[model samples]
Structures are given as structure tokens and as C-alpha cells.
Target: MVNHALQVSAALADMQIFALEGSRPFGEAVVRHLGLALSAHEERGFEDGEHKARPLTGVRGRDVFVIHSLYGDATHSGNDKLCRLLFFIGALKDAAAGRVTAVVPYLAYARKDRKTQPRDPVTTRYVAALFEAVGSDAVVTMDVHNLAAFQNAFRCPTENLEANKLFVAHFAPALQKEDVVVVSPDAGGIKRAESFRQRLSHAIGKPVGAAFAEKHRSLGVVSGEMLVGEVDGRIALIIDDLISSGGTIARTARACRQRGAKKVIAAATHGLFMADAETVLADAALDGIVVVDTVPPFRLHAGPLKDKLIVLDSTALFAEAMRRMHEGGSVTDLLAGR
Candidate 1:
């Protein structure tokens, strides 16, 4: 057995961890990694589609962390999961939890951070307001689409965990050789790709190259088929924040292949795989796809492309973050690469 004393201390002895129905597996993994058990919670769904989640154990004057990834699955839509998490946080506050942290691994609606057209919702800010209204002292999530927007959206303390170290470690062996180029699916993600490239290069002890595709999306239509930077005869590693509908990654992969890229490997922080994504991602030019397990692979399992899918666990990363937060330690090391 692992040493619980080293993982937990008197400073966090009054802390309790809970997980909603949709995030049980992820929460369990985190708890197991931390050498702890999940606190008791009860969730009930009403016939009219209403839901309620309540902590079975006492939380009064105790620090509480709730794990719920706001990603949609076959049973629950993203909005459904978000609403449930919000309500549960509110309930915890009402029950007098000392400090409440919502550990949302895959935060949904993060892409709607900005206003592009008239009367745009700016849903990210609105979601932040919802969390604030529910009395969340802090919000923790991994790889938010817009880091600036995510921070500005929330009034409460927010921690945006980076997956750079995790990705770098996972891809180090394959990227040790030279002639590898990290490509961002679009211009908007050029910085993200560059950061990944820099760390990957450092890991492999070589100077990796960077490239980006020009993509414009308006009203469900995507255009701009331009590839910048050299990709010919090089292994292209496409990096993005997440995948939804799989259009951008597919388009970028095809663009790279057309430019004579030897191989295309795609990596994203979250893999939503929505609406025929499996078919779209099964492109001949793509060699493999890597994603962190912030959200479980509901769509990719038992599919034809399953063989090419690689999932990296985020449990250890999250557990370390939680431990630090509970013990009043700095999280700067976690955000080093990005």
C-alpha cells in the first residue's frame, strides 16, 4: 500500500472529496492516486428531467472538492452536466462547506469565450458567473480553450492546468529523432503548438520545427486552406486544445499530407469526438491521435479507429494539483511549460 501519511496531512485532514455521477471514474482515479477514498454523495434524477446531488457525509466547516467534467456523453448533454455541477456546488455551500473547489477536468462551453458576431452570448463569461453565483471559492480545469478568457470570465480563483508536461513525457520517445514538426490545426492555436514544440524539443534534445494551418469557420462552414511552414518529409505532430466534429484536425492533417508530410500525429487536450467524428478522424493521412483522459473515450471505444487512439491519464497530474491546493503549496511548477 502507498503511504497515505505522505500524501495527506493534518492540514487537509478536514477535506472531503466528492464526485458527481458522470465523473465518478475520473474522481475515483484521482482519489486512488492520492491514496484516498471518495466521500459519499447521492444523486437522483427526477422523471421530469430534473436532478439533485447531495453530499451524504457532513461537509460543514470542511474543505470540499467535487470532480465533474462538463463533457457530454450519450446519456447526459454538456448543459445537463453543467447544470448538475452548478447545483451541487450551490448545495455544498448551503451546507456550510468551508471551501469548495469544482475540479472540472473537461470544461465545456470554453470555446464560446469571445463574441464574433452581433448579439453573441459570450457563454464562457456567463458560465463563470453561474459558478460564482453558486458560491464556488475556486475553479480548476485542464487546458481551457482560451486561458485569458477563462481567467477573465471568473471572479473566483481559477487554476488552468497545463497538459504540456504530460504530453511531452508521453511523446518524448517517439519524438527523440529529428525532422519532427509540431503543427497547430489553425492560426489561433499557433502559440499552443509553439509551446508544445519548445517543450518537446527540449525533451528530445533537438530543435523541433513549428507549422500552422489557416482555418476560418463561420456558421458551420470552414474555409482557408493554406499551410504555412515546411512539413515535407518530416513527422508532423498536430496539437490543438480539443476536438469537436473533427473538421479542423482532419483539414489540417490533409493539408500537411498534401505538403508531403511523412506522417501526421494528432494530439488534443480533450477529445469530444462529436457528430460523426469517428468517421472524420479515420483519415488515411493520419497515423495516430492522442488525447488526455479528462473526458472518457465514449465515442472512440470499440470503433475502427480504436487501434490508433492513445489516451494519457490525467489522474496523477490532478492529484498532485489537489494535494498542493489542499496544503497551500504553489502550483507554478504545474504551469511551467504553458
Candidate 2:
């Protein structure tokens, strides 16, 4: 282990890590876990609303990683952040950086991977193309909406970090003596819920029940009433890739309570609380909510719902992945909890 640590340290000699404006806090946490400091960078704003960002120090022939989470906030839109990241990457490549990897914790437009409507825009693919065009060598993100679609969209190497292990670690001890059931908010997320269920079961050394609620969306309205499997007297754990608008989570929590679930906890990777999500998710049916610090809970305010919200740290996971990639180690092994 000492030798391996030394080798990894050596590998990082030529590495450069930069955090964009929006993700400074998250990037600092990642660097803290890696026992390093963030590299210097500069960002300038123009009177015409244009912006520029570039590394302050040299990055020539270095393995550069730019940490930016593409989620909109009150200050800057998602498009603004994306454009800044792309431009910074282009500047790095233009300055002769050996490799540039985009470390996006919460990738925007990932939900639009497929075209559900006629003449719909495939924004996910377009975003992938923009990254490639900027000369990005690889991209890393956590728990994308569709793993297959995300992988296929990018010709460059892409890493999708699963948050199941993190959730399992968080829920195992408390649930060991309780009757637990993992639930998917909609039929489409059955696979994701099953994966979490399997991991949680193994962690607690018991069988975990599985269920899914029926969800149908037309235009912008969501209407569904059907729910499968039994949740009576059991703790219903609802899982999804993200929570946007909080409609699905609120609906699922209500159904779980209606079916006699003792407690309903919603766990998702990204917390993109858009629109009136704060009000919608504050339902009494939901006992608790869990999410990672991918997209910060900027929209949530002090309230009962804020009291129940739990945000877990994902820096260690990303830090380890970066270390493994730099040291030519196995990211697959890391994910397998080895």
C-alpha cells in the first residue's frame, strides 16, 4: 500500500485541477479528499454578458481535470456554465494540455437523451458533441439519467459513477432491524431501484422487497394512480436518478403512505429542485429525503422539508476515481467496493 501510494503521488506530479465558478465548493471538497489544492484559474465577465475563464498557471502537457456541475442556479444558467467549461477546455487544449477530462457532478440535459415527442431536440447528444468539439478527452459524471444513452452519446471515454454504494452505506445500519422495501417512482426506474435493492440487501444481510409506482406524463402534466407490490407497515425507500420539480417523488410518497407504508424516504443522486419543487416536496407523506451534493440544494429554504433533507458527500468517490485514473488503477474495482 505504501508503494502504491507513492506511485499515485508521483502520477499526480503533472496533474492540474480547476474548478469553475459555480462548482468551487464541490471542487474544493474533492481536492481535499485527494489531499491536494485546486489549481489557479481566472474568470472575467464582460459588460455585454459574455464571460471568459482560463488557467492562470501553466497546463502544457499536464493531465487537466475541470470540475463543473452543469445545473442552473439564481446567479447563472446551466447554459452559461456549460459554455464557460467548454471554452476553458478549448483554451487548455489550445495551450497544449496532454489530456483534459470534464468532471461534471450533475450533467444538464441528460434527461433529454431521447426524443419522446415529434421533432424533439436530442440535447444530450448535442451536449456530448459540444464537449468533443472542445477537445475533451473524457467526461465523468455521477448517476446520469440513462447510462447507455450517455455512454453512446460521447465518442470519448465517459464514466458514470453509481451512487448505490453510497446509499447502501447510509441506510444499512438503521434498516437492519426494520422491514424495508425499495421502490421506484415510476415503471421506467425499476432497474435502478432493483440495483439499489440488491446492494442494500447485501449490506444488511437480508432480503429487501421491491415495488414501483405507475407514472404517466403527457405534455407537462403528470397523472397516475396505480402502484404495485406491498408496502404496508414497511419502510418504503423511493429511488430515482434525480428529483426535478419533485412531482414524481411527491406522488410516489403519497402512494406509499396510502398503501400503509410506515415511512417513505426518497433517495436520488441529483437534487435539481426546479420551479415549485420546494412546495411540492414538502408533503407530509414524505418522511425523509436524501441526495448527494452533486447539485446543491440552492432552491430549498428553511422549513420542515429542509429539516428532513439529507445531503451526502460524494467527494470521496470522485476523488478516488480521479486517483485511480491518474495512477492507471481500476475504477471498476473501486466501484465494486474492493
Taking the candidates one at a time, how many backbone clashes does each contain? 0, 0
What's the lDDT for candidate 1? Answer: 0.90
Listed in order, each prediction's TM-score against the native is: 0.96, 0.97
Query: What does candidate 1's lDDT look like per residue over 46-72, in tens digits?
Result: 999888989998999998999999988
Best by TM-score: 2
- Model 2 scores worst on lDDT over the 10 consecutive residues at 1-10
Which 10 successive residues of model 1 have the least lDDT summed?
Answer: 3-12
Enumerate residue pairs that collide in model 2.
none
lDDT per prediction?
0.90, 0.93
TM-score for candidate 1, residues paired by index? 0.96
How many steric clashes does model 1 contain?
0
